[model samples]
Target: MTADKIKAAALAHFANHGYSGASLSGIASDVGIKTPSIYAHFKNKDELFLAVTEEAIAREWEQATAYFKNRSSSFKEKLYGFLRSQKENYDEDERAKFWLRTSYFPPEHLHDQVMKDVYNLLDKMETLLLQEFKEAKEQEPQLNSLNIEHAAKAYIALLDGVFVELLYGGERRTEERLEASWYMYERALFS
Candidate 1:
């Protein structure tokens, strides 16, 4: 569909150029349309950017959390898998790049709008993590001593730290950080 093509082009441009540098004209050129055709799909660049951003955020969140739904994996496995998968996503996925870039460096005018979605996603992440931690503790005697709320918060913090490393530290450094953080997390949960 034309709309999908428009969005896809916008994603690449916005990812490479950032908000102010990306333009409707360029996006339209990529889509083989004139600048005004974009208006039919998106009211303005802001609307298009936010749409692409929110979509990327939602997709990234779903991908990052997919491990939690594994019926066969243990909770610890789920946590480790999440960290590994997120690292892969950051390294390979354009959407992840866009999501991370927009999240940290949103256009000045759209900061509030961007944060609103981001905060909602964070809240959802925390709640799901808390629930999973509680269930895992119930199932794993070793985890009974670990407070689920604290564990959830710590896990979220761990995720943030790992993401920061990947964003600035390259694949190798990110892998190093992931392993080290997992070790500490495992020790704390079991100790």
Candidate 2:
């Protein structure tokens, strides 16, 4: 339970402050423990940071799995929902914030390690979306000429663009970007 509590506090601190800015002392203080108490659960700050990062990645992956697992939603709903969830989650979820921040703005010292994790997620995401797009192309005659791989990559590109807007473009801009991106995405798939 101490470890879990520590991770919870660490996640918040990391989400708010980032890898370089987050502190074990501050995390421990938030957890109502001494700085040294953290050593009982983590060897060092890098270890603790990675622990939190790994947990965030797992949580995000699970969310995506849940979205893709639902059998009832039409592909368009599922696909758009996935894109929209990026904004919703970033705005409303702390774990999502940490995942986004760490994925894009990792600590310079941990860049290689952080990127390894990010690339693994990207590969998995592409594989899943590619399958979904392939199925969509099969199910919708409108998508007869759609190139599934290109669509998948473009979709992820749109998602990445949305990520940039979310981080710095403010709420109105992020919404506008999402709306425009979705419109273009729909045109690409349906036109």
Candidate 3:
């Protein structure tokens, strides 16, 4: 329970302040404990950060798994649903924002591990998408002309662009951008 509270506080702090700016002292204060107590749960800030990162990734994977398990019928519907759901899932929330911020702007010392996490998630995403695309192709021979690998790459790139937009583009514009971009992407791929 204390460890969870510590992690929750750390996630919010890191999301708002970035790595160097966040402090164990502050996290302890938020958790209503002394700084040293944090050491009971986490060896150091690095460990805590990585733990939080892992938790965030796990949360995302769980969400995606649930979404895909109960996903739509058509291939386009599945793709669009997953894409839009990500935007909804990650927008401005503490855990998601912390994960996104750390992913793109990790502390210099943890760059390699952060990137590894990114690659791991991407691989998982691609695997899921490839399965869907292959199934779609099997169902409609017309889609067989669409290269699954290429489509997966393009879709990941589109998702990355949306993440970048979320960081820089204000909330008001994000939905509009997503709609317009999704339309263009669908047209280019399907039409």
Candidate 4:
């Protein structure tokens, strides 16, 4: 329970104030614990930050994967579900802000670490997507024209682009933009 509290506090801290700007003391204060007590759970701020990020990423992936798992529809339907899930995931208040901040203005020194995490997450996601794409091709040989890897990358990039827009635009506008992007993606991928 204490570890969960620490992680929750760290998420808010990192989301509100980037890595360099967030302080362990501030996180401890939010959790109603002394700064030193954090050490019992985390070796240092870096480890804590990574833990928070990992948890968030894992949650997001779990949600998406589950959405895909029970889906019993065409590949396009599954892909559309995935896209809608991406938009919804990025629409969350704290999570959306944290992702936007990190994507656009990550700490300079932690660039490698950030990239590593992103790549690792994507690699895991891609494995699942690759299997889906292979099944899609087997089901509908016409989809052979679309390169699965390229399509996956494009879909991911589209979500990232939509996420950036949502960060700048307010809620209503973001929804409109996401819908438009979704339609465009559907046409591009399915037709």
Candidate 5:
């Protein structure tokens, strides 16, 4: 229970402050414990940060799985739905902000570790996407000419571009950019 509380506090701090700026004392205070009490759950800030990162990534996967399973009728629907859904972040959701920041600029010391973890998550996501693309190509005669591997890679690249816009462009700008970019991408794919 204490460990959960510690991690919960740490998540919020890390989300807003990033790895380097997050403060153990701040997290401890938020958890209603002294700074040293955190040592009982985590050896140091690095461990706590990694724990938070793992939990955050797990939560994202859970959400994605649920969304993928329940939403959309066809493969194109699911793909486009996922792309569109990615554009909608809760205004108060710091986790999304934290994820964007960490993806682009992890702590210098933990960059490799963070990238490894993120890439692992992306691998799983892409594998799922590839299966969908394969099925879609098999079902849609028009799509048979498209290479599933290339299509999947291009889709992932588009998603990454969205993330980049979300990181640097504010909400209004991202919305405009996403609308225009997604239209162009769809035209290029189908035309």
Candidate 6:
């Protein structure tokens, strides 16, 4: 579909060249269409960028939520599964990489929008994590001793840190760091 093609091209362009550097004409050309044809699917470049970001975030959430939904295990198992899922989500596809890059570092003009989007995404993720923490507390009374809010925030921060490190370092190092962080988190929260 033209819409998908546009999104794919936009994502690639945005990833390689921030928002301002990427042009609608270039995306249209990537899709083998005229610049005006993009107007049919998106009213403007901002709309197109937002659409691509929303789609990428939705897909990532869908994958993570689905994985969590099918899992029925102990709270510790669920926690580990969630950590692994978060890593997998960060090992994103091209579109997702674009979204992540923009979320963390966007063009000056689009920085506000990117910040708002990142806050919204983080809020949603925090809500999900808080629910998991609450469930863990209910299932294991020992978790009651832990500060659920602090633990949840720490867990999210740990994932974010690992993502940044992985982007620079390779998968093997990332995995090692992730495991080390996971152990620390598990010991602190579960033990």
The alpha-carbon lDDT assigned to residue 131 of candidate 1 equals 87
**What is the C-alpha lDDT profile of model 6 across 51-129, one tens digit per residue?**
8877877776776567656646887787677667666756756766686677777667677876887788788888888
Candidate 4 per-residue lDDT, tens place, 71-119, comes to 4777887777766666676665576567557756667777788777777
Q: What is the C-alpha lDDT of each candidate?
A: 0.87, 0.91, 0.86, 0.78, 0.80, 0.80
TM-score on alpha carbons, each prediction: 0.94, 0.97, 0.93, 0.82, 0.91, 0.84
Candidate 6: where are CA atoms >4 Å away? none
**Which tens-of-lDDT digit does each residue in 51-138 have in candidate 5?**
8788778877886788777634876667777777777742457666667677788899999999998998889888877887777787
TM-score winner: 2
Q: What is the lDDT for 117 in model 3?
A: 94
* lDDT per residue (tens digit) for residues 1-191 in model 2: 99999999999999999988898999999999999999999999999989999999999899998889997988888888888888999999999999999999998999999999999999999999988888877888988888888989898999999999988899999999999989988877776
Backbone clash count, each prediction separately: 0, 0, 0, 0, 0, 0
Indicate the TM-score of model 1. Answer: 0.94
Q: Candidate 2 or 5, higher lDDT?
A: 2
Cα lDDT tens digits, model 1, 61-158, are: 77657767777987788888888887887777778878888888899999999988888888889998998988988899988787788889999999
Model 5 alpha-carbon drift over 4 Å, by segment: 90-92
In terms of lDDT, model 2 sits at 0.91
Where does candidate 3 stray beyond 4 Å? none
lDDT of 3 by residue, 1-191 (tens): 99999999999899989999999999999999999999999999999999999999898788777777774457788789877877876764788888788889999999999889978987998898888788788887668689999988888888887888888886777787788889998997778
Pairwise lDDT winner, candidates 1 and 5: 1
Candidates 1 and 6 compared by lDDT, better number? 1
lDDT of 3 at 140: 72
